[model samples]
Target: MSAAVSTILPIEADQSKPAADPRDLLLHSIYEPDRDIQGLTARELEIIFQAYKKKDLANVPVRKAPSYSEAEQSALELWRQQVNHHMTMRISRYSMGCVSRQHKTSVSPAPRPINRTEHQVFQIPELLDLILSFAGPQVQIRAQQVSTNWRFSAISVISNPKNMETFRSLAPLPPVEYGQLLDDTTRSLPEPDSQQIEQFGLHVDHMVSWWRKLYRRRYVYFPAKLAQRDDLPNGIAQSLNELDVGQRHGDYHGSIHTVSRTTDLYWLDLSQFQINPYFDLLFSEKGRMLHRLGRWEIGLRSNATSETLVLDDSSSEKLLVQAVGSMHITNPPCRSLGIYCYDNCVFPMHGTHILLRRIRNSNGIRVAELLDALQSCAPQLLTKWVKCAEHLRRNVTETGHWVDSVWLIPGTPRFRIHLDNCDMSDEVSYATAVWTPEMARDAETLIGASLGYQAHITRTAYMSAEPPRATKEGEWLPEELFEPMKTECGRSNINWDA
Candidate 1:
């Protein structure tokens, strides 16, 4: 307190009075009257304040805060708008439902009316980058609800292909709450007119019927043991004439039936496909869109890199829809499957999921006789792999044969895909492998047993659902698999010198 306040003598100074407890003092101070009380002048209070706190308060210097960038200011303003909108709705609701409208108060001057901007803020893509960077799923939904303009801008920015070549679209934000929340339209805008809806290329009148793939190719290697597992594809390698199935390369080495399909990509063709195929989408997330490669069609490197925006949810407000399709391929002989072999090749006998040949290395064995030995000895373990021309669909024959082989079967599962296999050689499934230790051990043993120097085992896995991927690989290692009992034995061990 002030010096004057401190100097005030207590009433208890009189010997005639009994000492009072703090509680009694407080009660008396609140309820009793005191006529002799004195007040300090403002000047006296200042003097006391200066004497006690001059150095701490008066001597402290003030510094200007750093200014926000245009983007930052825009982000702040967007959030401010959200708060204002939410509060306005809540107050309006309260006024209608709870407050007594009949009550009147003294006349007061009316507040000034707000003058909103003539142009919509959401029409600007540059502004969207800044706003989206600061938004979460909830905030995004709010933006979508603000007006048609905002909804279009947000979707356009996210669907734009240019973002990725620097990466936009939720890079800084948390994942969108897809499937959990529906897009809500507030501000009660009248049903959007044709011009507004056309701006976004969304169809509210007629829903699209079919989506087709731009192209398709499939590869199935021999040793398609349907009897091996009940989970295998039914129509694979069944000698169908219209289906384009059967072996060309497998005649000498091991049977490899290559199936190619060029058809309208109905959504159903995807899940029922019997072979391993490279699948991709060509949808334009911002406008007219949605396409997928036929299922069971082997993926080519050309198909790997796509420019289309991927879907996260199916929201009419956000214009999103989910697409998924995959078949069980027991032993997929296609590119990017099991051991990741190329197209048009049969697995040579022995057991080789893949053959890593450097630019200088020649084909070790005649491609014709390779699959023959293994298929004859262990037809049950026939692996489906790819054959490559020095270069196959591309002009890189020089480096075409050079591949990074990561997985094997008949041994413990390895890597992210488990490098594990189903029972059938050409089995294609729509389910993703959970990849347990048991799964890993089973594959390792089978692979460890099947391959000789000539031995090769590449287990292929196919799933139509999205493969889990992270932008930055965090702390993780492949699950540890038990070592096969005979780790160091293969047909290559049989020295021809014998």
Candidate 2:
């Protein structure tokens, strides 16, 4: 090797530029086809190739070139800046990618679907609707946790106006959810019709649950039409049509007056009207508008007076008798008649007498002579009448011992007599009075025929006495009135015991 090197001549450089191979230049220039190299001219391509070749392979020099024209130079400068910016961004992204990959390999995989069955079965919109309609608020809230899609659907369905209306009408409801539905729907609808509002009044007879909720939550307010009026709210009357007035709290004393003024409801239930003062108002000229009157029940407390005296000179009993008598004389007559007196100490015989008198006194009344004849004979039956009257006066303690008797006349159901609260003294005697159905029927026929009206009398007697004797020893004796006679040593005849 040393001998060959000693004879070596000086090395000559290759002066010819390698023949310009278009393909090679193209390939070299196309380092980044995604960049601006694709549209390069021949001159630009040559410059790029030269720059690529001359520049150190390890560190390619990036230099700013001269502009071709003013516009071109500005454009080229902007392009250079953009390209530089992009290249910097790319390098950063590439480094991040490598780091991310390294980190990802060390991490565990995310969880797969846990409830495959539920995931498959629960479709977003359908599930939301079902949950809203059938499921409770608590369940709907739980469903919302599954994903954003579920939550969105749930909110949309619940908030939709049509959906809200439908939900409001549905039953087995959750009050809170139903309330929200109603509020949202009403708000979404166009302004409520003023005419309709006026005609319908303020309060609507909605579902009972809704009414209760509204009442409890203080959501009920007087309607505008009602509020503007000087009188009580019209809605009160409207609501009264559906509501059981008896079930409501308060005196119910002034209600008759309000009812008489505001409404034309024919059938008035007076079962709950306890205040005796209201009776006059009910049967008065102003109150007689009622075409169909419900049974009137009066509960007589221990302290209650024998007679409910009205402020007017005309007694309530007298007025009621007059009203009943007048009604009987009417051509068509009242379709029904019911008088319920519960736990009342006043005798029905007295009521009947007053009714007969009113009928007899009335101008063109047909029952005068019959009622007079009955009255004339009433005294002859005084013993039985007094006994019955006394029996009626007795207070019944037990509910089971109530005596009920119904008498059928020529027409209509028999009049029913319910004798409640018959005390120990009157039980046997009262039972003896109307013991048989035939007796009851006869009594009804006599009373109806006497009154000149097709009437039935039903009488029920309630007693508080101990059960009847099963054995002789258990027989209840009236110790208060009768005691075993004791022989006196000196007297020949038994002396009356005090």
Candidate 3:
């Protein structure tokens, strides 16, 4: 009656279903040997308990010398052997991961768009003018360099998004080109890239020059005939008006939005959004356009110079309540707001460079401890995806047809102030520390709450949880189990017997 044995709940058997093949279950799972039918052997269960919990099987005695049976002794030996083997495997995996990351490219400044877009579609003066107006990566730095028509296009798109189909238009994205990025070694990884980096008296002139350039029209390329969109942030509107009225004094006031991750990483970290693959309206012209934008490749580049980054004003942004209009960004007043490393096992970020931008309380000892706590959580990238599945299903269900667009939630929540504060963190700390079943469950929680991500669990854990469940036709819950669910606090006139 020790805690280990007491904590392990027994699963009810499916009396109507055929027994599953142990080999098949083993083939599909790395850790699990389906405890229902193709169940764990005595040694197999012990191996898991020892490997993860550092405990023997729930049924096994806490102390095992005199009371041990021959089978239990064998199981103990097998557990010890398996533990050694897995430890070696873990070391090997970590070594290989180090080598692999060396070859992987970190964020780099992107290739500047050509002086003029020569694609056949943009050759026409009218079409080129309109396409250039819509923002995001496609419009690029060429926006300011172009002719009057180019100026007109941006104004057109903002006034009415009906012209934004080209921006939302989807096609097979080409492989990313990494050849021509400007590598500023001084301002690179150690420097923290942009705005949130500079602190104290050492960089006053730098800030002055930077602000001077921004006020001098070198920063924003706001259009002349601008008709404000309905959803423009109030601060941005004030900034725009200041830019207009303050034009003569060379004064500029504006709200600045900062983002940390590169664009390619944006769509990949989609747990922050609710995407419905099953929406019927997605097939329609408008819905198709909106959905296509969700799939659009925004490219691989650092957000360093992307001061122009704006949320697409899609339905997804509405769900996120986007405190600030950017991805993978924690807003002010949140600890680790500008900090972007989640230490995801699957898609870990290279964040030593982000320390360059750590502003405010980041220098304090308490901040370092928080940083360590964040690292210890070591969230998997797709945990949010699995967690977001319920949200997506609920959103779609509540919306009930007539859906027009997908949604992105920018919920870059703070990590728990204390490790014990997160209920799932206890199991997740172990799971994500290496790998385990709870890693999958905690992944979703981490994504939405810690990282601005959402989506599904890994195939292994998902399959283990959902293992090709089969049931006889018309099979229902057992009568014994069903009877307990009949208890109700809410008033109901319906008969329970029926």
Candidate 4:
């Protein structure tokens, strides 16, 4: 007989004695707990257990009764389920083994190799680099893990500086709310206060809030005027026009403009200009228009460097987003600033947008406050803003959704995107003009619009030619937009104007 048949074949019971009680049989097996009964092996004990399972001890009534509690019954049922699961697995494995053995014996001796050439084509340096450059950072890192060749190929391709440009070129164009003005055929614009730029520019806090807002957005003259100042010396005012400042090429006329917060940008001026400097529109190949607001600045560089500092425009924005995002998720103290700084890949320049030192010292600030301020002043940037927030929250904090304080400077420019904590006594006082010549020029235009939007609502109301006038005093203002915002600001003892 086979070993399996010999082990499982039943022994005929003698017809003289009564059948053994199932309870006594179970008691005999478990009474000692540790000492093996009759020196039975694991397989022998399993056979006896299987016999009890087949008889269904759960339903069988014992003459010598010991009833089980509900808890005990539930536990017993769960244990039975587990045993059943194991049995099913064992049967499946045995069946699979038999089928595999049979298959091996009957199959052909020679098997055709899979066509790896199709998969191998992706490893081609040029094609792989191009494809990988289009993927987000997360996907690129994962692709590197597939094989040694892939890691080498991905590392080399992603490391190239040229891929940055390719990434930008290939990315979907940003949504432009105000840039549409640049395209419309109407010579006369919808009323200044009625415009999207004016509505988004209503915040009273930062100089960026009111400073860049246009007095007039007659698209015809604005672009031309901005272009003229490209040669102007120290003409930061040209930024007001949202003109492309960096290097330009035939294939690409200029960089894209965006209002979203998550983008990789060269410059960002917070003042009233609707197409805020970095957020300005770009007229690219064949009049292609797109926003630059929410894109991340993926300026790739090799990791094998020491004492490295890179002059990147968006690094400050990236790190600030990271820092604020980190604080939101981790709820850590100021020391956590070091971790954020270290993760930035490069040391950001001071006064570029936000300084690491200033953030480290800012115990009074909260990431929510930063986000709230952005939403109030520039709601369009919120999605990318939150993306940056979540990225830092998950990666640095190693958690999701937390809150904490951070350092911030008090008051300057319209937008509070950056804060300065210069020591008042130690810092040298200079007789610097409050507004630069360009700023002063932009201010005149902004003041005119502000007065019209605020105090002159009555005057413009009766005119049928214009859209509906701003209904109340400071009616178009951000403070008036939502009641909760005003209440929160009030609780914080912060003056929106101040």
Clash totals for all candidate models: 61, 21, 18, 29
Summarize candidate 2's per-residue lDDT along 198-287 as a digit string, tens digits: 554533444223445421111122222222122344554445333333222222122432223242212112221121222223323332
lDDT of 3 by residue, 149-176 (tens): 5544433433343432221112111111
Name the candidate that leads on lDDT: 2
Candidate 3 regions exceeding 4 Å error are 1-66, 95-328, 331-498
- How far residue 218's Cα lies from its native spot in candidate 2, in Å, is 41
- Model 4: per-residue Cα lDDT at residue 202: 31
In order of appearance, the predictions have TM-scores of 0.17, 0.16, 0.18, 0.19
Per the 3 Å backbone cut-off, how many clashing residue pairs does candidate 1 have?
A: 61
Worst 10 residues of 4 by lDDT: 401-410
Which sequence of candidate numbers ranks them by lDDT, best first?
2, 4, 3, 1
Local lDDT at 13 for model 4: 39
Q: How far is 46's C-alpha from truth in model 2 (Å)?
A: 99
What ranges in model 4 sit over 4 Å off?
A: 1-126, 136-138, 145-147, 165-498
TM-score of 1: 0.17
Tens digits of lDDT, candidate 1, 1-498: 223233343445543333333332222232222322224343543443343232211211112112346654454345434433433342232131222332243354695664446356545767875676456333444455455566665555444444222122212212111011112210111244546434312321111111111011122221211111222233321222112222122222244344322221111111211221111121222321222212221111111111111222225332511111111111111112122222222222222233211011011111112112222322111112111221121221111111101112211111111122122133222113466667655554443332111111111211111111110001011121111121121101111111
By TM-score, is 1 or 3 better? 3
Judge candidate 3 at residue 14 and give its lDDT.
Answer: 36
